[model samples]
Target chain A: MFPGPSAKCARLGHFLFLRSLTTEATCAVTRTPTLPVKQATRPQKSDKTSISTAIVLNRAPILTRSSTPFETAYYSYQARIRRALHNPFPYDFYFKQGTLIETRFNLEERKRERLAFGPAFLSKEDVSEEKRAADIAAVEQLAQQEGEGEVLMPRTHPSDTSGDVRSLDRKGQRNLYLLLHVLENGKETWRFPLGKVEKGQFLHQAAQKDLYAECGDEMDTWVVGKAPIGVYKPRQTSAEAQQASEIVFLFKAHIMAGQVKPQGDHIEDFAWLTKEEIKMRVHSHYWDGIKDILSDH
Target chain B: MSMQVASQAARHSLTRFQRAPKITRKLRRHPKTGLPTPHVKIVTREFAPSRLEEHYHTTLKDDLMYMTYKHEIGERPPPRQIRMTFDPEDPYSKYRHNAPVGGSQFHKKPAPSSSPDNVVRLEKIQLHTMVKEAVANKSQLLSAIMQMKALTGETFQGGGHHAVEGIQIVRAKKSVGGWIRPNVPVGVKVDLKGQAMYDFLGTLVEFVLPRLRDFNGIILPPQSSSIKTPSSVSGVVSFGLPPSALVFFPQIEVNVDAYPKLAGMHIHFVTNAIGVGAQDRARALVSGFQIPFLRR
Candidate 1:
């Protein structure tokens, strides 16, 4: 079980305290104009002030990032130092003497030690050549009986090789964000799923609703918090200046299950892209606003 | 002088078959304390990469920051002055310790502003267990001490660090009517940090919890419970493991019969988070490590 919905409500209360403060400041700024002018223009200005909620639906890294060559080398060096300086292993406590398991462990340990310190570091083993061969064979047989050897799944997914940006499984080691290719101004533009906040709707609630409305209700998603992670304002042209000045509040949400099914014709296509890929597809101004909110890895 | 010269002359005329005398070196010691010369201190550090540590950096840090962030438009208003400080000009107060007018309102303190550096993370894990029988006979504490040592693999001041207080003896703080006496050893405790902390956590999650019967995750307090309690602000999440669950630990599972009695431990996860709602943040961090929580 997780923190109940009430916990979110309590957090929303905290966010409201700051929201009230900001609202008060804005209210004061609007009151600076002449009383008659303010009263007459208030309704028109309110109508022109557009607030929208956008969901930066994210898929967290499913796999650990592979270490760089330098990191691997450093780690191996540190491991060798640890091995050289470690306390003696209690063989009697862990394994019975003259047992096959103990013999196998010794063989494995010797191989590891030789790898760390080089072959010449150890003296010749007292055991005869035939006995050593027999021990190795017995260990191999035991390993087979226990089904010890199994190939691990490759680090890179099949979708990655195929360059499938739509597949959620494509980037396992990077934070992939859902970017919708939508018809804006009769042209295709890549952006996060965005929709205007309905009357009396909370920003976070609007974000959740917009995500499901655009991406479909099939996916299980959880919005991160009550407060928006960041905010983005679209550049207004002179022709559109008379229209509403749009403010998009971005809320982060994680998709636990299901794929994006673009609900309608408005959403032309959708791609799960990493931060770098998202930057390439979206407008530079749009990227500048949302880049910091998205994780690099 | 004549005898010494004659011996030197005789030594120069030695036979070719004569063997050379072996040379012996004396042990080096410090002149001041008369102790043997010490070897260079070697302190071992993290030997391998920690999976949980990496997870904290890559995933949990960013998520926690976003979740716990409070949007502040401007500088925070200074904390409310509950009590005025005694003036230094007042000689009466200057000579004595000045206490707050009421009491310290530490529990009411607000959380620090969220930052990347201050994201809630586990600092250390304290595993403590009180053995009742140990009060009766001090030797009864051996089994508990052995259990602690085996569980943590820590010794007093291990890894050449004086700050490392491995397994510690918890003594009774106050005298009880018939049960405990002050300064009497009754319990064992160990504080695990860095690699050891993660290792203990991994074992608990992978080997212990799943096998623990009747556990449906740790139960949360009722929704009406007060969040302003001192424990809530201390940034500690405490839970007790049943004695029967001790066997589930692989270290103890190997030699269950070695100890006469097993003791249940109270594990406290201490985190960097402090101030109001700190326990919740601590719990969030712990749950990130895959320790489950439940609401009843």
Candidate 2:
């Protein structure tokens, strides 16, 4: 319905017409939306020229085209790292490719058919311990061959890292971030879900709201006013704030889950690790600080 | 009328009969008896924030601007990405191009599978185009852009009074573009010394960049799963200095975070050049200009 080539009238008359198709009426472009629009004044021939322009916000939605990017190296790092860092109960096993796209080899066509990114982050329950471990191993093996170096993760992969598949939602986009760190104890582990800024809300409130949203069952640790922090990357920008700047504080909070219950299923099937296990099992640089986080307590 | 109706009915019947599935002679039938086959099965496919993602500003501010890195590497499409190094010393040194063109000898992956590749490829192309355009405009200089907008723009309707001063600052920065103005670089250290300009600059860098980091790219974070059946914990990802590693100076770590000394954050507005053609060059051209405030 949106900006489709077929008009509404043509759509309604599809089967009624004798010819399989009808032609669209001519339309004229009255105006155009140019970007980083320049000023509407004459250009001066002076050696040093100054042009006046207008900066308008690109109010269009983001469109994505990628298939199963999570299968890529970055998400491989994400899936393994999160599970290792926080878990209520130690995982007994992990199965890889439980969510693999089941397809037979097509000799005529040599490529593998694919599935969605959801299966990677959403189906942790179905994967057997062995499979998850194997996939982690596979990813680690690839990382190992390249050699480890401290590199800041670029801000472009989650959307374009994969080769085949388009994002279902384009331009119309919003995101929920969980700035969580892990907690440690004997037989009991906890997740300290960081708060987030709401759309148009103050960054500080967003963080508190995020904390509360994830604070189900662990409301005891709820508190506002965390220290504001931020860094500049080529792409990071805020939505509520015009320039995507930050003025909110971040806090470090922990939980006492009281028992080894999987109150949050996302937290289930995760393995508990000592400092040694963390250094060994976790592969991504993002989690390089997990041991330090746990060591605090 | 009756005759016409009868003829039409005949035509309909004939059409249905002709359209009926054809038997591959004996293939559709059993050697001894005949029966039709059954049909096949069907398959199909949250926003919660607790996760951070690498962002490509495909759409930003109001979704009008797309921020893709403008590559200086000519003719060749930009790589899917230029790895951002923990070592802030070199930002675009290893921006290798890994974006492949097609599969095998002659065929490309089907369009469905190639969307991401196409987007990455297109974004690289667009980056170059943007650079060319920006370079063309550079003869034009960083043109001052003035924006006309609705004001009291700081408050949200939900009694939230949200301050999008960042956007306001950006818009104002653009407004300055409409008139000639000199830009203050982001990395060069300057004495803020109680200037309103410096105060605004400090707020902009301190509050905006980290959150904006993930959404500025072609990628976005995976949705947070259902809480009750939280199938998988949201993946945790971070890229910062390894605390144990000895740092030659604290400034490097702070700069690693894109903090400490960076300015013109108010001017880091990008045009829609992501996942499109010839955009990388435009951004790369902009990248050539150092932010006076940000230091290595």
lDDT by residue (A1-297, candidate 2, tens digit) is: 232211322232233222212211111121233421321231111121111111110112222323233333343333333322322321111112232221111211121111112222232236578865676566555557769556865545453455211232211233211222243333333333433333334333444455545434433332211223221112123332222322222233322222122234344332232334345444344244233323211
- Model 2, C-alpha of B79: deviation from truth (Å): 53
If scored against the real structure, what TM-score would every candidate get? 0.83, 0.15
State the DockQ, from 0 to 1, for candidate 1.
Answer: 0.14
Task: Provide the overall lDDT of each model, using Cα atoms, as 2-decimal numbers.
Answer: 0.82, 0.27
lDDT of 1 by residue, B164-221 (tens): 8999999999989998889999999999999989989989989999999888788889
For every candidate in turn, the CA RMSD to the true structure comes to 12.1, 32.7
Off by over 4 Å in 2: A1-196, A222-225, A229-250, A256-283, A288-297, B1-296
DockQ of each: 0.14, 0.02
| Residue A293, model 2, lDDT | 28
B176: Cα error in model 1, Å = 2.5
lDDT of 2 by residue, B117-207 (tens): 3232111100001111222234221211111011011111211113212121111122244443343221111111112222322333344
Candidate 2 matches the true fold with a TM-score of 0.15
